[model samples]
Target: MKTKIVLLPLDERPCNYLFPQKLFLHDDIDIVLPEKLGDKKIPAGLKEIDSFLTKECKDATGLVISLDTLLYGGLVPSRIHNETEDKLKERLHILKDIRKANPKLIIYAFNIIMRCPSYSSSDEEPDYYEEYGREIHEIGAAMHKSHLGMENTLPLDEIIEKVPEKYLNDYISRRKVNKALNLASLELVKENIVDALVVPQDDSCKYGYAAIDQRDIRKAIIKNCLEDKVLMYPGADEVELTLISRMINTLKGRKPKIYLKYATEAAKSIIPLYEGNMLSGTLKYHVLSAGCQLTEAYEMADIIMAVTAPAGNMEEAINQPSKYPEYYAERNIAEMFDFIKDRLSEGKIVTIADNAYANGGDLQIVRFLNANNLLMEVDGYAGWNTSANTVGTAIAEAVDAYHFGTTERHQNFLGLRYIEDLGFCSMIRQKVVERLPEYGMNYFDVRDKEGKISELVKAELEEFIKNELSSISNNLKILKLIMPWRRMFEVDIDVKYIK
Candidate 1:
């Protein structure tokens, strides 16, 4: 018999919904989801979700849920929701009822500690955030420092004066309600209503509103003595896949041993952009969360993870300088590739976490792998978004490959990462964005998702693969491409290998 697990994704994005399904395509497990998950800013159908859960949990061996979706309809709505505390609490009570109805169901849940981006953009935030987002972030950082009796570099009073009193209050009030819900989720763990819970800090920094909330959430976990049952880390979109890997491991009574290989020694300590902790700290949480252990003995390892992190400051892939900098001199790409080759020779499942840059894969690394005809040799590869996102994604794919062995789906997933992460993000995205103005379009609004801009993207991607990745491009073809939110930030792609 196959294992049946119902998933409530963080949102309708490809990362949250499609990635996990593709990862488990050939496995003896089934991932069931509700039919109507809402769009970018539109909230999901709460009644549909409630009904789906009630019906699906009857015989399901496990349930992986995003509390943000259940409580506020989706992740975006969680930030701008104005529902009263009583109403939010009423929605949360549904989980307890589900637990009561299915006493044997193994429930793994996650909630996000909302992020405050430093830039002033209302793309995924409240309308007023377009004007006050930067000020709000600065004020939160200043207040957090002052509360700890630390020096404040920001002009705290001036920044506060810039934002009107009403906007600040509204932001603070929404945070309070969300924090309360986080605590409520912890209570479910204490009561055994939830078997395990993860609270991911999305796009976090060391000192800010998210970090402050993280501290309070930590206190609650300690107060309740739920350390083993709860985990808080710097990630968002990848947590569900991590939990799904953990669920499969638990069901099969397997805990894979992973051996880490960094491109440079300093890669472990360098903190990537849009994150709070060092690479090593975040890796610890992600590895353990995926039900895998880090091993020092290579001979005893079930998987080898080659992490291509930065030797210095991490920048966006598109903004990288043509001439390599002095700080990156220490990253030995040759040695990393040789190590992966050696591991594969020894029958080890080697995976690459290409996080040398933010928001995309390293072009140098991709070129090297393709040149050596090793693009399809690795078991897994991911370097799409944040460091945590990349690490968690690689870990999940590696875990799945280790247990079930790599299949055609796995190879296609590896190809997808190469085309999307390295091809589009690093090279083609910028080229196409630069040409968008000719079509009277912009990054946020490309007019139509599959219109001229997407066609331009497809042409650019195909030409890129033909020139840069000739070894694998002959066998690979793009089946479908669409900008999921009608934006240039992310894309939903379908790729297949032709015989």
Candidate 2:
């Protein structure tokens, strides 16, 4: 018999919905999703999701849900929702009823601690955030410090005077409701309605509104003695995939052991941008969340994770100097490449977690892999978005490969990461963004997703692969490419690989 798991993704984005489905294609697992998950900024139909969960979960063996979607429509809507606290609580009760209907279903759920972007942008925030976003973030940090009786570097009163009272009040009000929802989800774990729960801090920092919420959530977990059943970490988009790996491991009674290999020991202590904790701290939760253990002995490990940490401070892919500075000169890529090579020779499932850059893979790492002809030899690779996002994704793929072994689908996924994470993010995205002004477009508003901007990107990527990444060019072809959300931030790519 095959395992059937019903998923309610964080949103309708490809990372949340499509990635999980593709990962399970070669396995005996059936991942069932709701018919309609809505668009960016637009909430999915609550009635449709509830009905789908109630129906499909009855026969399913497990359920992986994003509580943000169930409580506030979707991730973006969670930030701007105007629904009252009473109404949101009423919606949360729906989970209890589902548990009643499917008594035997193993429920795994996650909720996000709302993010506070350092820069001002209304693309995924309120209309007022475009103007006061940075000020709002500063104000939140000041307030959090004041509440804890810490010294305030930025004058809170001065910053607060800049924004209108109404918008600040509105932002604080929504955060209160969302934090309450996070606590309520933990109660589900205490009640055994949810077998496991993860409350991911989305795009977090060391001191801010999100960190304050994380502290409160941690207190509740300890207070209720639900420590083992819940995990709070610095990740958002990749939690669904992590839970899916856990579910598969549980079904097969497999707990894979993973050994961490960092480019430099200092990389473990350095906190990547947009996150609160160090890379090592987050990796522990990610490994455990996927139903895996970290091993000290390489000979006893099932997966060898080659983590490419930054030399010193991490920088965005576009801003990196053509010749990196001395501060960014500590990473020993040649040594890391050799380690991967040696592991692959020993028939180990080696995976690469490229965290050397913020928004893309390290081009140097890609070139090394290509030069050594190890691009497709490794089991998994991911380096996009935040460091936690890349680490969680890489760990999930490694877990899947460990259990199922390599397959044609696995090879395609590996190729997709190289194309999107390395090729588009590091190389093509900057080129496309530069050309956007010529086409009367900007980064946020690319006009048309499949128009000239995308065509330019496709052409540049083809040239880049042929010239730079010829190792996998013959087997990989771009089947489709579009700016998902019609922005230069990310691209939705479809590719075909022969081997």
lDDT of each: 0.89, 0.87
| Residues 344-390, model 1: lDDT tens digits | 99989998898888898888888888888888888889988898899
Model 2 Cα displacement at 201 (Å)?
A: 0.5
Q: Report the number of backbone clashes for model 1.
A: 0
Using all chains and alpha carbons, the TM-scores for the candidates as numbered come to 0.98, 0.97
lDDT of 1 at 352: 89
Q: Candidate 1's C-alpha lDDT?
A: 0.89
Q: Which prediction has the highest lDDT against the true structure? A: 1
Q: After superposition, how far is residue 362 of candidate 1 from its true place, in Å?
A: 0.3
Per-candidate alpha-carbon RMSD to the true structure? 1.3, 1.4
**Candidate 2: lDDT of 448?**
79
